[model samples]
Target: MNGNRFGRLFQVTTYGESHGEAMGVTVSGCPAGLELSEEDIQRELDRRKPGQSMITTSRGEPDEVVINSGLQDGYTTGTPIGMVIQNKDARSGKYEPYVTAPRPSHGDFTYSAKFGTRNWGGGGRSSARETVNWVAAGAIAGKILDQHGIQVKAHVNQIGDIEAPPVSFEEMLEHTEENEVRCAHPPTAEKMRERIDQYQQEGDSIGGSIYFEARGVPRGLGAPRFDSFPARLGQAMFSIPATTSVEYGLGKEAREWTGKDRNEDWEFDAEGDPIPEGNKHGGLQGGITTGQPIYGEATWHAPTSIPKQQKTVDWETGEEKEIQVVGRHDPVLPPRAVPVVEAMLSLTILDFMLLGGRINPDRLDGTAGEYDTEYHPSSPDNE
Candidate 1:
């Protein structure tokens, strides 16, 4: 409940439940005078909305976004931006059985233990549907970062045991959206799709990882130890429902190598700036960015919700039961999670950028007492 808010300077507080009437977010600390529209946020929401493709859920929510505050004539006013997306497809009947039985591997039991009671419909605040708010807030952060040439992108790199070959950032941007799996490799995406279909047909689910990258991020945007870039990034990724592990740079593979093999030596770019000979460090050095592309992977466990019959104890009756979690659910998560990953990345980097003084926190143009921003509305008297 207390943790619904995220960020320090650039903050977002999300509200509403999975089966609630609507989901919404309030974003504060964004600089004033940036051009933002409902369409900008809606575009990102569309990517993560339910029922998008065969691999996704069958729910038919359109995920339409409406910006209700914090703008004037299409420009941000440096105040809190409020946006809402209504839940039009919620069906609670199927979820009723699990209200007392507690779904396996889900937050149901824990939520009840903590709150003494829960919404129990569509998993309430714990459902992945809550991520819709994150995608919306990230869209605004993406717009803020866009003005500074910072680009964030992500792709499904692995589904179950089918791992995609490493891809370039350009490939991720160009080919990620081409397939239902959202993998950059076309042939691999086909394989992933087929694999997902196999699981869907079996009434089961699978897990996977997402490879995310941020380009044009400045160095020294993070502090050592606690407030480090990777630390914050890890928190953001792990907060997503079902995320099991997160790793940066060489990640878990580095454990097999000696220090010499893992260490990245320093070199100079054409501009004479210090750079790394290799990016094994994943664009981060000692918790601060190295002015190189920050890249990593976040792994999600198989979704807990499955039609396959699962066993659990009925807390109220003290009896055991087998239940089929039949409802609209995704067989695999990474495809729809792609935008959520990007949104968190954008939000994290933009917050750091503002904290590092790389961008003006008061105005997008970095100039105080000036209404001359490119996004500012102009009078038609001259026309």
Candidate 2:
């Protein structure tokens, strides 16, 4: 709970539970006079909301965001931005059986052991639903980045064992939105969809990797030594539910390559600026952005709420029993995770930019027309 707050300059603290009456976030340190509306937050929420497709959960919550504070007319007031999304479709009845029988792969048992009490209803705060607040905060952070020409995009790169071919950020932006799986490769998306369908039918689930790329990121946006750019990005990425692993650039593959192959060679550009032919370092050298795209990948495990019966011990009886998971769940998590990953990237970059003195704090006037309109919400790849 202490770690719920994130960022240095532009900070956010999220509250509420997965099956509670409502979930919300309090955003502080925002500059005044930025163009913001319910639609701005809703657009991102729609993407993060469950029941969007067959591959995601069937929970019918509308996930509509209500801005209770932080704005007057159509812009931020620089105060704590409070927003809430009500839990309209939660089925607590499905969770009655799990009150004592904690589900595996979930935080139920561990949370109970740590806190001495647990909200057995729909995994409580541990559910992926907790990420809705993050998606909302990320949307605001994204708006801040957009004002400064920074763009973050993510796509499902691998589903289980099926890996999509390497694609550029622009190509991914164009093609990822074309399919439900959100992968740039049409063929791989089809295969992944088929596999997800098979798993859903068998009452099981699958996991995969997502690739995120940050474009138009300025240099010198991260601290040197401790809080490196990639290190901060990885920390935020792992904050998401089910995120098991994270890596930047060549990631673990660098272990197989010699220093010459793994290290990026810097050369002088036409303007005498440093540029690298290959991004083997993932755009960050010495824990700072190198005026190149910052790229990273995250791997998530399958959701634990599969219908397949799993063994669990009944705490009251002190005997083993099989649990048939109920309630809506995702057959695969990568597709839905694309936006979540992008949000984290946006938050991290914006935080670093603010910390690095790249973003002008005076520019936050909360008036839509006051800020410069240099960047639009169009695909970053096209730019």
Runs in model 2 deviating more than 4 A are 365-383
- lDDT string for model 1 (24-92, tens) is 999988888999899999999988988888889999999999999999999999999999999998998
lDDT of 2: 0.84
lDDT of 1: 0.90
lDDT of 2 by residue, 1-383 (tens): 45778776667789888889999998876777888998999999999899999888889999999999989888888788999999999888998887878887788789988888977788898888888998999999999989888888989999888899898888887998899999998999999899889888988998999988989998777767767887788789999989999999889898899987776667987789878877888888888898888897999998778988799887777988888987888888888888889888888888777666566544564333333313222633112
Assess every candidate by TM-score: 0.95, 0.93
The candidate that achieves the highest lDDT relative to the unseen native structure: 1
Best candidate per TM-score, number? 1
Clashing pairs in 1: none
Give per-residue lDDT, candidate 1, residue 90: 92
RMSD of candidate 2 to the truth, in angstroms, is: 6.2
Query: How many steric overlaps are in each model, in order?
Result: 0, 7
